[model samples]
Target chain A: MATLMDRVITSKAAVLEGSRAIAEAVRLCRPQVISAYPITPQTHVVEALAQMVADGALKAEFVNVESEHSAASVVLGASATGARVYTASSSQGIALMSEVLFNIAGLRLPVVLTCANRALSSPLNIWNDQQDSLSVRDAGWVQLYVEDNQEAVDTHLQAYAIAEDRRVLLPTMVCADGFLLTHTYEPVIVPTQEEVDAFLPPYRPQHYLTPDKPLTMGAFADPEYYMESRYLLDRALERSQAVIEDAAQRFNRAFGRHYGGLLDTLHMEGARTAVVAMGSVVATLRDVVSGLRDDGHAVGLVKVRSFRPFPKDALRSALRDVDRVLVLERALSPGGVGILAAEVRAVLQGQPRQPAVSAFVAGLGGRDIPVETLQALIARAQDEAVEQGFADLKAELVEEGDEDES
Target chain B: MKTRVEPAPELLSPGHTACRGCGLLVAARLALQAAGPRVIVANATGCLEITTSKFPQSSWNVPWIHSLFENTAAVASGVEAALKALGRQAEARVIAQAGDGGTADIGLQSLSGMLERGHDVLYICYDNEAYMNTGIQRSSLTPLGARTSTTPPGALSWGEVRTKKDMPAIAAAHGIPYVATASIAYPPDLVKKVKRALGIRGPKYLQVHSSCPLGWGHDSSLSIRVARLAVQTGLYPLYEVINGQLTNVKRLSYRSPVAAYLKPQRRFEHLFKPGGEALLAQVQALANANAAKYGFPPVTEGAEAEDSD
Candidate 1:
């Protein structure tokens, strides 16, 4: 006689790296279909899963697609028929699948994908950065960032919940830092398959291609109806934010893990200086905050989990008490400050006693950002806040010479 | 074998707003018949999209979606893929329909991706020679010596200096399972080709010669007449490429001269003027070369099948 936990067990607790954690989480989800093509950083995630499927650990259809476009197409087909689907890609792979990515969103299929954040190539560097994920910010998928291996596992479980929620039938992206989280192994508390089973119910597609009940998933919207269709999509996305938060709360109640809804704050109590960041950089910020606190400085950290919903009110409330807010952005918007900084500034507009916000663009093109550098960034932002009082808020780029200045 | 075949009345109706004698409307009707009731169409931004689906009202009787200008094939592939994944392959047939500009020029890359992926989809290009919805712009499928908004006759050059794109040849090169060319002039033949394309397992391409009366500067009644002449003159030969091989050629026993095809339309009026005869003769020679290449066999003495009305 097997126990309830054994009946629900999808994966075992093992010392797995972040990338392998992603592979294992997806395996436990038991995706009926996987379509992937190899690209730097993202290759290992699929490769590990391919080996699992080959070894019969995961019983799923693995499609070795020719291009990123075909890979997206394969998953779109598999998912359209009401099957659980999964895919992984990075940088160039994301760009190649850009067209189909938009289509998958428009068709409203709950396709789960992991983006090992990497730099876009022209000169072709396969290192860590958020350029790929940030490039697809408006792609209409529920985007989430994981700071460590545990979050990677936890979020994959919640992604199915958020994406498959009847009210929010949208695709979800689980993004992690390339090489930083993907290659770095750590101790993660894997939820017993039973816990996951209770957390994530079987996906019952609201609309799918079926002969018994015929419904059109994708229909032509001419100009007259096009704007209205887009309006509906916007409304759906706005509704998804609440759905994600509710799903997170439910997940916490079920697993006893306080997976914060949309966004998470650490050590923001009575702090005058705050640093806003996402992905694996939050771990470095946590270390920096502890070091700063030991030296009698009031510094804190805020980890942005759901970048798509933007969590404007929550972010504003978190930074209200702080006199200085330092934003560490992993990608640049070419002619302006980082995209995140622009979005955060937009949210801070017309708010009472808004903190002196400074934008620091770092970790671009897979450049390494050490904990010492992040500490310097926080210190410089606080100093600038006291001296210049938001005058240097839009600091464009922290160049090599400025490293010593900070 | 002159069997009477009646057009299905349910697929498309007469009260639609398509221009009178519009060949694309005829093509759409035949295509819908072949696709039957369980069909979903992904239409591109073109004349058909604008005229049929103008927001407040839609002329489409079946499920239809209008994606972007160049992504009809990609969208249809998505729909078909989803349907197949859901184990409802026979629930509906996905059809991607676009104009010449959308298919041959702008949407070519996405179309190629869909075909290369071998999606269970049928892509139909209603070749009306120019971008009619955008007002007579020259498209890749526009024939040589045809005057268009972009390719107007001038002192230095004639209209449309380049030859019409060999679309069927290019599609066949993709190694798709089925590829064919048809015209609205031959409704039964076009319908049969559509049915054949749908019956194929993988990606299929069908290019239909749809005439534009307003854009071509011809009498509205001359649309079908001009399309028939195009096929008879070997200017737009009807043929099928099965499994990458040019299997069947829709040959005309006695070919007509290119002048008969060009004289009715104002777009090709320049080809019959002063020194244009020489250019017209060159056009005729090109048609003759095509006939020779496709091996159009001569008709026997008394063995001829009568055209069914």
Candidate 2:
């Protein structure tokens, strides 16, 4: 029997950059209000939506806010009114909206934030990195990182469904790399509104601010109840795994694309060694893994799409047979080590058939993580285990007192 | 002025946990009367939210949400934008209320964003001149030479060095449909302005001068008197700007000296001492400047105050 999970819906294939694909997917979701503010690579996503609103293609209020803080607040308010809302930002914009980010999630307002992942600044750099999004990992939001433009488009479509599910009414951060995926042009399959509608239902919220019945939301709880509220939030996020998997499966059935539940795996067949990573870096690692597999190396790739709710069971089962696991991260914890790699170790801990996990940080401030870089890292790890270490680091850059005053 | 009309059906019930003679409570009730039933209030974290909605008991009859201290305007902007998209913007109104510190300082950017976006929200700033919720810390709206927790009078200092933040003027700069300053002492005038703002379409800002008896170091019984004196002395003007034009001004029937307002509050008690006389005069000079700028009608020498009651 061809159930809904087995059926496939065809979409119109078109060439577009990652940002445009996200905009089109959001348009297909039929959001009623979009809080928009521009920052670097994320600006294109918002601009595309603005054009859609201007051209009468999307029926929504495109609020051109002054800052990312206001953008997030605008969407937070809109979502509270039970309007399906969308917003996108990157880098400092995300940091700027940090306060409201936690508020949205804590309030359990299902606001979909398309976070075009970028490097945070001191010496300002506008490039692809996961620091901005990963820094906010503990903000009680469902953070998902996409590997490519196609995955970025599909993940956005599924993000709304997973976020809006009544059982998991938390905000979702659909993160894609800044300039790499956002600016790179690729062939993306654009699903029709009818197809998207069939996959994702109209958002109906259980809690909202409206005139019909008076209710108070986002109220402060005393210490007696604060822990209870936090516990409930934690439980809801943990329970969200089922909804995310079901949504992803439904989306795959509706559209001829598959995003593995929380994490995607490549060439895992009888592999002895595996590599785990997130964001655009996963694609580079996947290419390296495939090339090494062709050379008769027993290696595989595990792409972590959802960084939050850590997909423990799925990840544990996926790597149950592997003997060694390499975890690469695009984000570092400043004084500490890799962000994603640390979480990966936490997830893989306490398993019966645990793999020897090694952490390697790469691509900070968007230093290009090409296939060659991953290939070289693999060769180095073959001889010595890279435990919570930096991969392909510049030797001269870290040497102190290297500068001469003019 | 409409005569003898009973206040609108109460959305805020009695038994709210406000301190004795909290002017913000009265202002909130009057605002509720003006805004009526079809409004969602995005209240910022302050005395109002903490007092009204505690634990399981909420004093508000209307839909209300107390988010963070510095994001009420942004939340209200969201509510209004959502209503616009939901095709119910006209039927349901959005109001963002914050205290002086929230409105004039920490929340100023959000207020600016809400107004600049023109999201059809009515934002009310309950200006108490200081942060009363967090133990009366001096705020931007804290007048010059007033004492607060953070701005104590010392050997070489005269308390808060900054003048009151002209919040209504700052809100007016956004060119919103209505920007007005009201006083809790004048309920009819204050409620009238709120209703008038509610009737307008785009963004409207109302800064209601709400006296804090605890923060101002005054007798609880003198709350109304203090609020009244703020306007009567021209320290806080009662005026409305409709679409950037000065549409209405509440001409003072009797103008009092700033001393009458400052002398009763311990926050300003320093200004009365011999060494602080100069600062007291400076405060009076500020009042005179407000009177001159607003073109307030001067009272006749022997005329009794019409508003004395």
Candidate 3:
């Protein structure tokens, strides 16, 4: 019930669920239109924003759509009309929105979305995993993964800045681990409206749907022009890397907190073994790496923040001196290797003194990746040639052929 | 002095790829003429979108967007929200449009959401019966006894056995402010309904029966005649359901036989085959029921009736 001025003057940290943190950041960004469908893990984010709109706390239109497909479409339309828009979904919802996700990016709308990342359904599990957002890796959106609640908040504010930059002008998805980040309550410093307004200006799209200047969008391109259009989209995403770094630096200048450009590293100073990961699992990796460094094991952690632009150069340089790089990931290609690990290997391939890049899939379908498993993985990387395997598989818990439960 | 009817400002330019007698384009042109230049259109992926706005060559003189096939209504909701947020709602009206497939089948849920939310937008469905843009696949709106690529008649089966989905009734069920049915044959009526829908504040739906020369296997020049025959036959009735109440029904002065409507199109050519009598009679019975339901004139003997076959 505090006034805007009172909150600005008393800018203090408050304990909040990660979803509420995202909602608070969205409110500060002043999205003119917010649309979303209630899905597991991501529901609370939109629920909070909906309550804020109802209570006159946020002056935005909260469009309650039928499904995630419509939710994404609503935001895409809103964005094309020169309005700052926000939406959120997870897991199956993201899968349902795959078509529209590609359409939004192809149309070059600077809409921002939050993915409360969850495992895809086969067994219909509603647990935390990075598979959903990572599944739409080639949707041409700037995908940023957050490690914790505060980072989730900061990354959202940064997302709007990064997406709306004229040079970028592509949709951005801020992926935070479902249940891990979305359900857990953590102390987060919510920025004031004035500060957010200063950091992120009003969205002024170069091309938009306005009667004053009639324009056509989402027109189908023939083969003659389709490849060039895709090439341009790729260039735009690649250009987004500089904008992402610049936004991070400016965010640090304004808020005095930093999420390193592209990828952030910890304890990589002259370390022989490095563990690469993303999302909330990186927080666990940080703890395990610090312990190993204290014990003089020469282990480090490379937290990949930007997954879409792939942070290929930043990762290559970060893992250049390492003797071995263990790529731990929460998502995999099912028939292939870890999604992030494969990309890491491709980026580090044929480099001078290329480090050994190993793929390790862990914490899938919301399985807890505790410090013991992290330590075991590091030990395996040190002793054996760990190519690509599940990190925390329970052999005794498996009943072979149980998957065919028909 | 002759009263001059100034032609509706051409919002849709000519250099597009729609067929020679595309009933959908005719309906769109008339509706857009009524909605005028001060409108932003959210179009679904269909014949209208594909033909009019091929990349780098758009026929639209108004601001327009074509997203996926099934999300036009939801997209228009976003456009309306954005306009409302920008305080430009008064300057530009919003229209979401799609083919019957996009409206009655794939896009129904999003359409329902847009209507339920009461966004101040007009959703227009150009009902050409089947998925004409996708090489004549059967859609939910494909009428009974008509043939499509997916619903082709064979030795054991009749084509498209299911009745067309009642989309206007579905729109009216949401308790929206307005829901109407129009035809390209009735240009003035279609234009009037479009303008009226745009003048209203909340969600409105207008389903225009647009005949497809290609899909229907009718002569391109007889497109309007075929559309008119549809209305006269009462198979595709022209009416309005306002605020959930049946308000207006365009009465047929000269009621035509269902055969007069169906016999010309190759899609229904099977109905004239040697063993196709019973299904043809069923088609007539449908028309009779529609006429009875909408209070149209009864089928008088020899009145607008074509060949006995």
Candidate 4:
């Protein structure tokens, strides 16, 4: 029998759900505390984690919190005590934990959370949408959107290294699209125990809640001091961009696979128009862009991996010379524009050659953004002026609001 | 010549922003004193957290953390889990604490989770009746006929109509090993309970009846007096429920009328007003019911003025 202290990792390629892949990767990281409440799409991840602990496959505390609020809180507390801790949630679960999300980042606890991105409820959709994580874009967590199960598994590894770095002690959210990534089965290569251990070292925190070295955490800041504390947190997140890149490089060195630093791109070179998006939809965009490039069209794809710390400089350089930038997003700002589109425009504003940024909202509330829809949207972006609207909207279904006039 | 008295170093330092004669502070000091040096406190956002940790200054000598208002128990669960993970559970102890609102109301779920999961944590609730820190708002644990900002006595209502939520019973229902009630009025008893709660292995609860002079409408000097009166009046029983059984009770030798516990506090002043006789009797009946339930003596004629101690 393997003792409690034994750390074991078995690397293999298996057809697994994104949730199972994430759980497997998390086990490789060997987090000391895993706390989560069951939410649809995000349930399988926590369930697998619970099973791992139950079966003695993982040496960790699987705290069965009553709600997602406590799930986040439990991990936050565990992280403050200098333990590598993890928790996962989706949609309303993420919304319920919104307060503690800011608390975790503000306190600079290196908690890595998996946000199985799902739509917010009114109609109560349980499928994929990036709105949940996007809504809290200003909450100070390092948000990394993964394009596939392999990337989701890989990002979890990079998330810990970036978050636990003393220079950038911020919580990280590895966002994989709900249902699309979390529920879909795909071939994922699990990193070996040796590879994970080499890539990410044991968490050695500079400041932690320990009796041996007593200190205070999460102190109440008055007006005079609160801004500066926030400033420090903001700066730490800003500084994390470099650490993200470094972790990715190191991850590639260790595992022979690399997800980009902050932002990743495909065929952006010498392209007149480019599609910029996040999450698994980026993979769909990649295929569309590849097909267009083969048909002798100047089109490319910009996969925004890091949504927070907004990758301003990388984005500026990527879209500097492009004539038209199609910002396809799964989240919207209701009255305004696509959440990622607004950021993309803001990032490219002062560049030497600014692109005409067009906002396109897609895949909201688990709505499908099929390959034909992407082709149609790309053709429209190439032909039309800079615009913002639902890319795949059935015009007949949307009311023109003649009632207001009546 | 004056001889200087040397005391053990305080785990909770004296300098902070707690109200003068604040019973929560007193309870915190006693609990920390009992738990000794090797402890980590996960305090919920309340008077204790605000007063002790005002950014650049902190009153906690031991490792302390203050998360959000309703997640202290969950945070303590994490701290305890981490300690266990590090194999330092023997050396370090975890304590989670919150005020009445943070404990009995908003924080109940997390506290239940911590207790149900059997984390080796000592969860303490400093029940000061109302949300004293937030301008005396009513919490679920606020007693009947008490006037908080939210439950002010008026033509439409007398005050808080509901009885105090039995939080200790709720904790005991989790099948935890120990669930005890203590009071800031009795230092020896409070400290003993804290120490005993810490000595146990699994989750233990110690709810300390703390007074808020500002919120309760009493002089700061009467904080301890009011707290003691609560126990003596049987409005707040000092007892322990261990392993689902009523194991210990600090039986009152002589009891006071519930009015004695109520009249001094501004919160319960409405109960003593004209046309408040029926409500007063109801309050007294609740206290009598507590005495009956906790194995304390029923009040007799002329016994209403005597002290328990």
| Candidate 4 clashes between residue pairs 3 or more apart in a chain or in different chains | none
For model 4, residues A101-141, the per-residue Cα lDDT tens digits are 99998998999999999999987999999999999899999
The candidate 3 chain B region of ten consecutive residues with least summed lDDT is B300-309
Supply the DockQ value of model 1. 0.28
> How high is the lDDT of residue A344 in model 2?
68
Query: What order do you get sorting by DockQ, best first?
Result: 3, 2, 4, 1
DockQ of each: 0.28, 0.78, 0.82, 0.76
Query: What does candidate 1's lDDT look like per residue over A47-140, in tens digits?
Result: 9899998999887767666677767766775677677889999999898788777877887888899999998877688988898988998888
Q: RMSD, each candidate, Å?
A: 5.3, 3.5, 4.6, 5.3
Estimate the TM-score of every prediction. Answer: 0.87, 0.95, 0.96, 0.95
Candidate number achieving the greatest DockQ relative to the actual structure: 3
Per-residue lDDT of candidate 2, residues A1-406 (tens digit): 0011221333556889889999999999999999878899898998999999999999998888878888888888889889999999888999989988988888998889898999999879888788899888888999888888888889988999999998899999999999889999987888878888888889888877877988988777888888989999899899888888888888777875786878888878787888888888876776689899999988888888788878888888778888888888788787764677677677778878767777777888878877777887676655555667776666567765312100
User: In candidate 2, what are the lDDT values of residues B107-162, reduced to their tens digit?
Assistant: 99989988987778899999999999999999999999999999999998899987
Model 1 Cα lDDT, one tens digit per residue, B1-309: 343346565655456677888888888888887777787777888988877766556676766766467767766776676565455677788888999999999878778877888888999999999999998999998998999999999887679888888888888889999999999888878888998888888999999999999889889998888888788777888889999888778867777777778888999999988878877877888788888888754323332223222
The interface root-mean-square deviation of each model, in the order shown, is 4.4, 1.1, 0.7, 0.8
- Output the lDDT of residue A331, model 1: 77
lDDT string, candidate 3, B1-309, tens digits: 222224877999888999999999999999999899999999999999999988889999999999999999999999999998878887799999999999999999999999999999999999999999989999999999999999999998779898998899899999998999999888878988998898899999999999999999999998998999898888998888877889879877768888888888999999999889999989999999998898888876566643111
Off by over 4 Å in 1: A1-12, A30-37, A48-84, A96-109, A121-123, A187-197, A208-228, A386-405, B7-9, B12-17, B297-309
List candidate 3 stretches off by more than 4 Å: A1-11, A399-406, B1-5, B305-309
Local accuracy of candidate 4 as per-residue lDDT tens digits, B31-124: 8988898999999998999999998999999999998999999999999888887777776888999998999999999999999999999999
lDDT score, residue B300, model 4?
Answer: 59
TM-scores of chain A in all candidate models: 0.91, 0.94, 0.95, 0.95
| Candidates 1 and 3 compared by lDDT, better number | 3
